[model samples]
Target chain A: MRVLVQEALFDAGAELNAFAKGDTDIGAVVSFTGVTRDVSGGLSRMLIEHYPGMTERALTQICEEAQTRWSLADVLVIHRFGTMEPGDNIMMVATASRHRADAFAAAEFLMDYLKSRAPFWKKEITADGSEWVAAKDSDEDALDRWS
Target chain B: MIDVLYFAWVRERIGIPKEKLETTATTVMDLVEELRAREERYALAFSDLSALRVAVDQDLSDFDAPLSGAREVAFFPPMTGG
Candidate 1:
């Protein structure tokens, strides 16, 4: 298992290939990538701010939980923070398991948990100004399924 | 003295990212009340507790959680991450 909290960009394809090559026992690999979106159509950049002291531990905990619940052979989580233009890759999660069901479920579970439980905040910078993105009730509700 | 930290708009509203405060509060809620009574910025930032979340020593916690032995407390809005 690997958890990375960084400001540098990563190649998602390389990450996936690297994860899949290590274990021959794994039959399937599932990956998900989150990208910044300009919902209002004029976003100049999205600034992601994360707690400097707590980010790595939080992500590690989340990945550990996923590992505990799933029959995963390998797990990788990479989340980026800092200013970036729209369409930049924000984060990615990959899960490898002996079966497709386990890999798919674990990947989805990781995405849901990271969406609301992680200690990161996003600010949308547009042509006019910047504004913090509010947490969605739907995201919180989504976590309930895992509980 | 305890270290209190703020994030996102809570930091912006309270005018600082972190501070050291000496207080007799026993719980997180009690500390919030004391800070709210200090000045308008704190009051404004803490106006609605429902919109905020708290962490004690970097672990997510509730307002009613005790502050005894905790060196740090953080207040912020619900996280928006993915």
Candidate 2:
């Protein structure tokens, strides 16, 4: 069972190593990591909000959707919600498959869905006041690539 | 009746995070119109529908989509969280 969500330390190297352990048939594992930014011109930390049951459901749905669209052997999605400092890993997705193309596409697809369709929200604590960050057009553009 | 949630700037504008609303509408747009008519705060919060996004039962949905049996509704700005 691939771990989908957790609220603890995420060691990227450990995750990849564990994913590939004794699985010689799996040729590729593509991964993406999202980190909290230190300088959004805001306060030192980022406050993330998400609907409890709904967030997990939404993320699982996106991962499943990616699976349906690609030939993926396994999918792992881990996202952290709450106060985060700069350089903290915010989210990570790892896709494994027998071929490199499928692994890469699944990883990209998962990220695109995460950026646009996920239910998480982030607020930047700034000197003036805490402010909600808006969705980036670049993210939308990123999602468009697979459409 | 449905539980409506507001987050981020929507909460700041509406001054609340969650509310129980009773309505007979079948679409998200209907709920928005009703909330906008409630008071100045709601109106201001929902003034620009283009800037907001709705989730029906936690799945992102469009404003005009039907909401006949939705147990929950959420209004928030476009997701900025990672």
Candidate closest to the true structure, highest lDDT: 1
Writing each residue's lDDT as its tens digit, candidate 1 over A35-62 gives: 9899999999999988877878788888
Clashes of each: 0, 1
Which lDDT tens digits does candidate 2 get at residues B10-64?
8888999999999987899999999999999999999999899998998889999
The TM-score obtained by chain A of candidate 1 when compared with the true chain A: 0.97
Instruction: Tell how far residue A39 is off in model 2, in angstroms.
Output: 2.9
True-structure lDDT of candidate 1? 0.92
- The residue pairs in collision within model 1 are none
**Candidate 1 lDDT over residue span B1-82, tens digit each:** 9999999999999999999999999999999999999999999999999999999999889999999999999999999989
**lDDT, candidate 1, at B24:** 98
Task: Encode model 2's per-residue lDDT on A24-136: one tens digit a residue.
Answer: 78888898889887665556888888777777888888878888888888888888888888788888889888999999988888888787677788888877778777799
